[model samples]
Target: MRSGGLMGTAALALLAAPAWAQSASSGDGDSFLGGEWQPVDPAELEQMRGGFEMPSGLNVSFGIERAVYVNGDLVANTVLNIPDIAAITPEQAAQVADFNRGRVVQIGEGNVVMPAQMAGALVVQNTLDNQTITTLTRIDVAVDSVATLQAINFSNLISDALAGSVSP
Candidate 1:
């Protein structure tokens, strides 16, 4: 198909422009995305002196002097020490739960049922694998809908079956 038009030339020119060309190196120019620039008032400088502090200790502080959560004690004690499990998505968690619900038969044991603890460990392994995949795909958000939830659950099951974790 032959395509020649002024609109096409204009579109190409716009696409070729650098994303940051409109901004000044000092950031004084108007925002390319449309916004007004207002300088920080010099009078507010004195009030900013009490804004924040840099801790000399190794520990980081969230600056919540008073706990407002329902589990105030737990929240205060665990906030800093809490592990970042947010990296795992709700879909991955649901997949792990569903995989755990299925019956597991140990191979070479003549279809003997696996012990509960051993089954739990296998479920955990599958869950960890799911978390790794979801992390790779950057989908570490809550599963609010059924379709998305099912997709992640099925993905984990398929992956486990393909990897020989489950029998055909």
Candidate 2:
């Protein structure tokens, strides 16, 4: 389980990419290796983007048990094996609750105890039938800043520090 601080940081890094990218300077903006500094080619960024792809599917299996003996006891869990889904239709996904079809969403918490790393894929990818269209430009320079701010708030995250403290 993350202490919550780390989860916030991870979220910040994921959300603040464009903000940092815009402010970052390349090699002092003068010269590097006896040549003008050039930002990485967009083509390369596109190619590198491929590494992020995953075979589409849903593999779901887990076990949990909450038992209270007469003497007062509770909690049990287990490991389950779900065959590879890799790719499944909405009908299949519906079998698992909250597994929404169309458009990948953000974040997953491991077990009930571990919290999800607070990260949003700023890069929204659309995967189609055997083809994935990763939109490079769709990363709107503008987005509501809530998620970004919440990320960098390392000490106390929004959930904990959501409301400002007032002093008289």
lDDT of 1 by residue, 19-114 (tens): 444443236455544456455574453322212121321111121111212212212111111112335456545544644444332222234444
TM-score of predicted model 1? Answer: 0.17
**Which run of 10 residues does model 1 get worst, by summed lDDT?**
133-142
Which candidate achieves the best TM-score against the true structure?
Answer: 2
Q: List where candidate 2 sits over 4 angstroms from the true fold.
A: 14-19, 25-36, 50-168
Best by lDDT: 2
What TM-score would every model get versus the actual structure?
Answer: 0.17, 0.25
Candidate 2 global CA lDDT score: 0.35
Looking at model 1, the pairs that clash are none
Root-mean-square deviation of every model: 22.8, 19.8
